[model samples]
Target: MLETTETATDPKRARILDGALKMFLAYGFSRTTMDDIARAAEVSRPALYLLFKNKTDIYRALASVVFEESIAKARAELAGDAPLGERLFQVIDTALISVMAKIAESPHGAEILDMKGSLAGDVVEGWRAAMVGQFTAAIGEEARATGVDLAARDLSPVMLADVLFDGLEGMKMRVSGAEEQRKAVRGLVKMVELAIRP
Candidate 1:
């Protein structure tokens, strides 16, 4: 587990994270340095150290904040007045595809993604759980609102949510770029609409 000096929401901490993310995306996680972050953040190296133990800690904080924002966006999108398919599409778009596509566009995207395997296991796991929960809630709420008894089709909220998550994750691997990802997500949304539509 990683240790942190302060929450990412702290004004100073947020400034540090913004700089750290810029450095990481611009230079890649394996190549970015704490000094780079401090310079970009306009903090002395020692002052930056006072808030974050290292660059990786700052990176983890950014990931946490991004996850939180994504989940909140997804939840709000699900609760919107859009039609079911559009709402569901927005949920996945906001939560999954948006960040993934942003990273994939970065010059060091692959390297940064590889860092996730070694440095961000816990944060990544938490993100996955939260994303799945958001999907499950949205699906269940839609089902109830539309009087779709998923149990009659041998499906539960958890089941459909798991399938959606797994399918989207797989789709990421299969696609090459952001545009393809958006199109694929819509196809998945259409399939989901068919399953639970009234």
Candidate 2:
């Protein structure tokens, strides 16, 4: 069943999503049944079904929660008075690297990546688009604050944002641990500093 408007704001629905996320991460999505989610959430099968129709629905909702929370946190960092490089680093960490790390660390990562006839993939794509938009806006703000016309340097805010995000995607593939991710963030911050500095 499709999600109802009230589902988004329902406390019980949030509980279900939380429980589902934990279960899905612990046991791969393929192994997590609706019964497991109901038990984890401490709800009856019928009650759980009232909130979400199936495992796929729960998974989609969980993915949406993660995506939205990350975007909100990233936007807060971006709007802060921190220096441009610092803000950019926080944005990348919250918006991109953390989500990638979560998936990589999960047993169901591959299944989530390859899931067919599911909305999980679409949720991730939407998250990426939102990240790009946040990054582009933050870059534009930085450019304006620094009086650096990105267009004058053969670039635009959107292009710079896309480049940084694309670079982070590549970095996420190669990094083996949190330390490596931190180093990658540093590298990205340096790149942005050099690109935007007068």
**Best candidate (score: TM-score):** 1
Predict model 1's lDDT versus the native. 0.80
1-198 per-residue lDDT for model 2 (tens digits): 113344466868867877787787788888899999999888999999887889988777777776777888788998899898898888777766676677767777767645623558778788888988988898888889889988899998888888888887788668776668978888987887788887
Colliding pairs, model 1: none
Q: What is the C-alpha lDDT profile of model 1 across 95-170, one tens digit per residue?
A: 6777767886889988877777578889988888887887788788889989999999999888887887888879
TM-score of each: 0.90, 0.87
Candidate 2 deviant stretches above 4 angstroms:
1-8, 99-103, 106-119
Q: Candidate 1 at residue 109, lDDT?
A: 80
lDDT of 1 at 179: 80
Q: In model 2, what lDDT does residue 94 have?
A: 70
Q: For all candidates, what are the clash counts? A: 0, 0
lDDT of each: 0.80, 0.78
* lDDT leader: 1
